[model samples]
Target: MSQPKARRSQLISTYGIGGLFPSSTTSYMIAGLHEWKEDRAEPLSEPRLARSLKVVALKQPPAGGRKDVPVIRFPYTQVCPSCRRIGRLHELSKDWNIAECSKDKQPLNPFRLILACRRGHIDEFPYFQWLHRGQGKAGSDHLMKLEARGRTSSLADLVLTCTCGVENRNLDGAIGPLADFGTCRGSRPWLGPETEACEEIPRVLQRGASNVWYPAVRSSISIPPYSEALSKFVDRHWPLLADREVVTPALLARVAELSDGKYSVDQIVAELDRRRGEEQEEDDLSEARLRSGEYSALIEGRDEEDIDADFVCLPRDVPADFDRLITDVRKVTRLREVRALYGFSRLEGAGGSESNLCPLAPTHTNWLPAIQVIGEGIFMAFDRDELARWADKSFAKDRARMLKVAADRNAEEYGHAPKHIDIVEVAIHTLAHVIIDQLSLDAGYPAAALRERLYVDDNMAGLLIYTASSDSAGSLGGVAAMAETDRLGNALAEGLVRLSWCSSDPVCIESKGAGSDALNLAACHACVLVPETSCEKSNSFLDRALLFGTRDGGNESEGIFSHFVASAVGA
Candidate 1:
């Protein structure tokens, strides 16, 4: 299995880190790092791969007795170009640089095609079986070969011939809506011998095609630090301190012994007392847990003196136009973020299936493979009263109704509804994009590098747009600098002005359900939509009309930010 070297950020965002991808010759699968339980003699001393996102690589010994670690292998079947015979290549021949047909001595080619279904199942192309599908002896042993009739590279020009000497099939009709490929075998080769029932017809795809795999990834921002200092200490040392029994008298004795004089029993007991109301688990990424922490962090404003702390929040005076609309503005000078890849979908958008992000597997693992990024950002805390007042307006309700209907229809078609994010959240999210774009120009960071973490729920209305990356040279401070009073005010004014009209305006602002899943109403590439990585919602639920007026012949009502724009212009 071969994979392209990608940046740590790209691995988290574009091609999933612990997900499956393909290359021309093989289907590459990345397994969770937590699953690598091999002994590490010098773990911290292990050198990181420069330029590549791969954190760990263990070599598999040539010979094995109950292999310590699972070896990654992609099975290959060979096709005889001369005799047109196809069959699985023996396991030993996997390392061969060149393979020849057993019967004809002709050079063989690695089978370049595979079968996959919308359910994310993938299997080797059924070359022999496909050519003889209708025949009674289709399952009988027969030599299969791939032959090209013409000098062209098109699928129509390629043909599959069998040694049964009677039938041959063209590669044509292997794709498209009416493709005749057989039902999906529901093979999850990446998971090793995993199979499931899939009724969807398989589609023939050349190895490494974009449609082969789509990863579903989830991420969360660490709000201050969700755990108490003692809880965090226990979590960091859980592997050593954890036991089958609860923290009983005997278990406490064992924990003290395991601590090796690092912490006394009295100290540990005190910490446990402090942990009573905290999350019991070491690694808790529950949706409710994450959202609640973030909500509290946003609503309960951080003190100005804590600006030098782990999660710095320095308040900025609101611009005159935004004084009534926004209640607080803070510069997040330091923050930590964790992104994890759990499962994936195929042939369909990952956002459509809400279940993919849920516990797809039967049981939960203690840990999920994660990448940590430390960065600087700006947070905008919206005035809840003002937000509600705007949302209750007749036009705002009408717009929300239209968006809700479209979203519901999309959800019904896709089998699950996207978690409810209100129109106000959409407004904040869209503005986040606008400012991110403007900051890209003024602050010198690429637009794709900036990320938005929306803090919106029943209790909180705010967002933090930050520069997040796993790179060593983190937090360039450009983003935090822009959060200063004068700079942030100017950035907001410019961002709104830019969102007022787009290069594709009128069409962009007026379109109903126009972007990636027909999710956007008035947003388009030229305006609010940012890189997929930058957006928390996959760039959905955005409407420029909510920020600036729907000025392109649609609802002509001024937006929530119109006061800021008007005030800026007047100034």
Candidate 2:
């Protein structure tokens, strides 16, 4: 009792979610940060206090304008569970360059939009941007369609706030989901916690409540000297456009000071002017400063420090070393500590070409087992059937009682309740993985044979049991895999690791398949990316992921790439 309770307790506390559980052992999820402060709240923005007003979206605040921190309407609460929708509302820097989307030149990572809540009706539609990264039009008016709808019932949208009381007008971009809390008369085990299910999400959001939210990396490159310099120039010149009025020589001096004599005031001003002029035309803002006296001060290229290459964007007179320093600094700290934990950085390849920034792999935690069963491919085919029979009402009753206590204690008035779907999913995957490894070991399958027969054989299957399905929410499946839910898989992988290093059976990665995971050389770990591939796209979500096969889009299928196959030939 203590061990199981302790494990669940560990999960809840790790997330700092007191409002989610019926007791310490009942694991519940959280949304915002751990606390809320009044200062972070906006003064009830009047972005829509009009009978008729035109709105526009921006990748960043217009050049030289005041800090109009651009906002995207990514739903932290996934309005639609399965698909390749882009409306996760994540942020894109204002400086990223790409050919316009309208020209059929793909905007990197462009996603479609789904599900819009207007009044009580949910008008779900898919929206795609037809422009370049920073060179496209924003659908501000598009979101207004939702706001125009009447208010919702108790469980509906209202004020949205961060744990720090920083009111995020739209949902934070796509949050990796952890578990589901379905509607119910009471709580259940799988969803973890039960407290405060009655409370409306938006209301709790306004006060900065937590729900399965993971901090994500927000700023990707494009900071430092150029951003700082332009910030100053915009402040001094574009008073109305700046986030704060009164950008002065002091701000410009700060930017220059940091540049180490690599950038000049003149260069900074010109870059801002060039970019600003183009964007302002869309919003119809005047860019008279280009020809006004403001342009006079930037005539000479005065000395500024070196700009770091990692932050290199529309480069100014900044030097090469500046970029190096930024690269070093990024590895240690998150750019936007609250919103994101990592960024997409370019690393130099052996060929010396830039490679995409790789996301760090997730690790297993206390409840997570080190291994899982093997030989469970056939079992997955029975998932829809097996789950139906495994819904134990007796266990659910205990789970519900525990959950109700949580709701009462947390003071929640509205929200979805816990569901048993996850429990069955977890149980089956865990059982399958365990059985596979055990069966293989008992049959005296050598480590090499185990790899071939259990891991790679088409008829032979294994589960990345702890991992989330392609459509899973809240840090996706990484959270579960880290929890060590599958025992058999963990054990088998361990046995293989020992034998392979001894040179008995070389445990290279799988390469011949379509839906597989890739092994990281440096970390010596196999990682799976979901909904990122085409094969992993489910039958129900086929149209949603819009997966193109090797013939159509590119990859095998759409969904999480659980079956990792490396690029180099012959394992």
Scored by CA lDDT, what does every candidate get? Answer: 0.64, 0.23
> Once superposed on the true structure, which residue ranges of model 2 sit more than 4 Å away at CA?
1-245, 248-262, 278-307, 311-571
Q: Roughly what TM-score does model 1 have, to 2 decimal places? A: 0.79
Model 1 lDDT at residue 549: 70
**Per-residue accuracy of model 2 over 285-404 as CA lDDT, tens digit each:** 222321121112122112234331111111122122222111111010101000112212111111111132222222211111011111211111222332333334343233234333
Clashing pairs in 1: 84-144, 84-145, 85-144, 85-145, 86-144
lDDT of 1 at 496: 84
Candidate 1 structure quality by residue, lDDT tens digits, 1-571: 2233444444444545324444443334544333344342111110111001122321211112232223243435666667666677652244353355566766556676777666767677766656777774644556556788877888888888765665778888666432565467777655556677878777777765666656665555555433223344454444444443555777677767776776778877776554333424424435655656665675554554433334566667877656787788877777766565556676666766745332223344433344557798888888877888888887678678878878887777756764564878888888888988999899988888898888777667888888887664358999989878888887888888767879997788777777766778888887888888688787888988887677644545558876666666667
CA error at residue 200 for candidate 1, angstroms:
3.8
- TM-score, each model? 0.79, 0.22
